[model samples]
Target chain A: MKRILFAFIVVLVSVSFAKNASAQSEEELVQICGMIAKDATFLKDFRIKLDAGDPPPVQRVPVILKKDVKYRFSVCNSKDFEGKVVLQLFDNNRMLATTYVIATGKDYPTIDWVCTKTGAYHLFFSFRDGKAGLAVGLLSMVEMM
Target chain B: MSRRLLYILLVLVVTASVSSCKSCSNSDDLSQDLVVPDSIAFNDPVPVLGETVIEEMMQNIASPVETAALIKGLKVPFNKDFLLTTKASEKFNTSFEKSLALGIYGCDLGYLNMYEKSSFVIDYIQVIKRLADDIQVGQFFDFSTLKRLATNNENLDSLVTISQQSFSRIDNYLRESNRPMLSAVIVAGLWVEGSYLTTRVAQVSNHKRIRETLGEQKTILIFLLKVLKVYEKDPSMAKFLTDIEKVKALYDDVKITYEVGEPEMVEEDGVIVFKQTDKQIVEMSDETYQKIIDSIQKLRADLTKF
Candidate 1:
């Protein structure tokens, strides 16, 4: 009787521990260049990518978008680089957006936009004239719940 | 032997049943305690993202040209006469010099930023010169005229009323219209930048000896506050207003604290010592620094809000 009771207690405790661990592991941090909406609106995200000038290192940020939603795009730099990072979003070889982000070293910042058309879009981050920095990131979109 | 085995089995069954029942009851009680507030529903989508409404509201209220004109016209007097003649003035002047230098630096960057991004062609240097002239002459001030215009003269009882109206219009437009997000973001950036300038000016005034002689800071604050008040009525403007309020509250606290002291002199080592409390100045500077950071963050967020 004592053996059966001890085994049941062990099984319950292990089950609860597994449940908690799985719950925690599922919550992951995702950085994305933009989010897509149900209406096919695209938002572009910007980040400063450090490149050593070879094949171009690219960081992919996860983006979630619904099938039909309106979206826009914006860009920002870390506070230390205020007045340093200049981001431009382009669509099909045309300039869609540009901004000179001034960061004051105390806030988490990102640019925002609504996606209007649904397809692959390219976003480019470059240093302004007389400024130098490397940028590498892929602009991806996902479905939002 | 058979009777003993049955008794043990029965005991085990009872214990298991009672434990499971207790667990079920506890779960039920927890569910009962989970009351949702009226303001928020489980089905209602959380505001993880939305259009940059604040930026849109600011743009709807006025164009950049109109805003620049308003800013230029709102100039207030910056004079030595208003300072604690010996100590406070000297310190104030020193700080003012540093601030002016910083302003110039920011202006330089601003001009560059504008030049790079703005499709509208305007001579920024010329505008800066005009701004300087307005500052020195102390006529055709931006804030004063803005207050006047906003109030519609005697028809409006107070600047606050005009602000409220303007805020409502912009706010409504943000909610009701499908405007370009970039436009809204740009407007918001300009507003935040303008507010930062105003707040910094106020910090300078807090150290001044004369309360009546309106410093650059107070003029900007009143002007910006009025503009902000106009936006408060709209939901989108309301968010921006919250940010402005945070900055304003900090400014007010510093202003009140600084005003409490009387300008007094102390003699030390054969030289008459005149001072405004260093503690106050430092505190005010710190607050200004923090507010600047907050403003920058808001500005960055605003830029993205399209």
Candidate 2:
């Protein structure tokens, strides 16, 4: 009886976990990315998805930034976690900065950066106390100073 | 019976790790020829792309938007004459040619869309649709909506955004479908065509920024070669890879150097913006630069041949 009860509990937990782990559909993700692209100051190039899953698969992008030009990095999410995902920028292993978190626990929607040194930079994405894949990030260069 | 349960549990654990592991310990050594020197880092030893992560590299691949912005910034005239002719897409009949033609016309569309040349947009959209349909990605496009967005001059960004979203869908679909070689080919076509456009402008205008941009493609070439090397066994892919390898050989002598400097942090709109002070400067001889231009033109012509 105990063994059967344990199996039932396991099945119930997995069903609940799978429900939370569901991914956004392709159409939904594309729309989310398109909405994020609208505000990019420069011709925007890529749309990245961040989910807070079991291990919360962190996404890293390698970008070659040019010197003296300011590039803006922005984050957009589904209505559930729009401003909650953390976007971290790094030069190699060293952490440089992250998106702004307001006093009310909301994050600033975008990060504007200037490249004084031209080299490869890594941008890491994750969620704050949320399920994985809850947010999407948009990368664009703000052409004007 | 006990062992059966153990096997299942072991498989489950292994599957979870493979799906979530972020470390690069699993990557086989990349081709030695494709490695970029520290002064010119182009790739990291990242794992195979996940379905969603595939779009991340779309940004890394030089966007048509970059060429559009460059042309606009240089005050260069919007010359439809400079773009690849729409009918040029019809010349190719094979899956390879059709795939590449899709890429070529796709870049041309980027230029046209950026200029908001309403008249030419439909033709290229038709071309892209035909090619994408040939390639089995037609479902990604929303024809009525794109046309609706295009009719309004102010909807340029939205129209383009929708278009860009389609490309992302292509990447996601290809990755999920386990046909990443096609994805690699599409990206190769996009990069080569975008490079061709830039070099063409550089040929006529001889603008320094354009020239610098052209030279910097050496880095993007490294990135491309790394991706292509993964599919080095496909005969068609092998043939294309060989051609790009030649282009890489042309870039062997072209050098890019970077100088490190103090990083900067600025407050913008209540957000702290961090700036890197490191500078990248390209040094290419007039002779080498010309050689690259000629080589790219010849290579593109060969690839685009029907």
Candidate 3:
């Protein structure tokens, strides 16, 4: 009986710690972003959260890009979320750059893009396999030409 | 033993249920807690865009730093004459007025920070803090840290980054609190001040890049008008909208045409750098550009009135 009680308590404690370790808030995401965006001018940050569903929808953020400017797109995903963030920068129908490379099944934490044209660009965010994801996307200006 | 086991099972079930519920709602609780006061009614007879879309537009507004950087790059001397007087902040009584002044001062602060004018920076920061406090968004600005950073010339980059973050945070907070109207006003104020500074400089310097930059604002002004028009029913915003519409009238003549070009991607230091062959062609007569400058100046003067 004592062994049973000890086993249940251990399970509960482990479960509690696991949950605490995984859950990440926006404040935490901002802290993560501070390190990633160091030495760069931060323009804005997008906080993204999507609940688990049969088909998760992609989140799109629109930004104005100027010519001859270098921009850094940095993303940090929550540990609690199984879905790895796939961020794509699009200008109308043209796909400029993405964080996830499908060819090698590789992912990157940042996409450093230089805008050669001045216009509206959209950032589309989703997770691999349409799974629910929580993350933050930070846009910063690295250089201006 | 069975009773004790049953108790453990009940406890486990309750704990699991509670924890799961808490985890699911952790992201949105603060936004829910912000209750809009009964004073200002947002009964939009014709809501142009949803709250979420307006919030996105607010995020996309060009940072004042970008304009200031471009102005500095043009070698235009940092003219303190162009900035709004910090003493004028006291004249803004209403939240609407305070929010707008907050953004106006924010743009001046960015300009000051860009030029690394540490001497005049403290006054603008203090006024910004006062205006932000008046509107309940003061929490975002770390006044002491900003002050300390302002004193040291070496911390220019840090000062700009932190101030940008603070303004962004205030914007996000306003949207989260369901006060997007205020957010729109703040953005408009920032844009107005930024345009005033640019157009004033353009009036004197007549630089091609400055003129091109002013022309680019045609698109930004259109987007801003869309956001501001949503709050037209509010008495205070009605006058603001009317004044801005006059500015927009001038922008209608500024033509921006885009040429399609392919984008090239190059890897620099293990990171992908994208270059586009596409280009935007801005066309505007000198007369029309002058008209825009005059209209923007008029609008800014009315906005900054005591």
> TM-score for every candidate vs. truth?
0.21, 0.75, 0.86
How well does candidate 2 score on lDDT at residue B14? 56
List each candidate's DockQ score. Answer: 0.01, 0.22, 0.44
lDDT of 3 by residue, B123-202 (tens): 99999998877777777787888899887666788888888888988888877666777888889888999989998898
* DockQ rank order: 3, 2, 1
For DockQ, the strongest prediction is: 3
Q: What is the TM-score of chain B in candidate 2?
A: 0.79
lDDT of each: 0.32, 0.66, 0.81
**Top-scoring candidate (TM-score):** 3
Candidate 1: Cα lDDT at B21:
57
- Second chain of candidate 1: TM-score? 0.27
- Candidate 2, residues B1-306: lDDT per residue as tens digits? 655665665566555555434222323212212322343221333235565555345334656766676777787778887677887887877565676777777778778887888778888888888887776666665556777776655667767666766675665565655556566777788778888888788867977888887777887777777777776766677788888787788788878987766666677666668776667788889988888888888889888665
lDDT agreement of model 3 with the native: 0.81
Better of 1 and 2 by DockQ: 2
Q: In DockQ, how does model 3 score against the reference complex?
A: 0.44
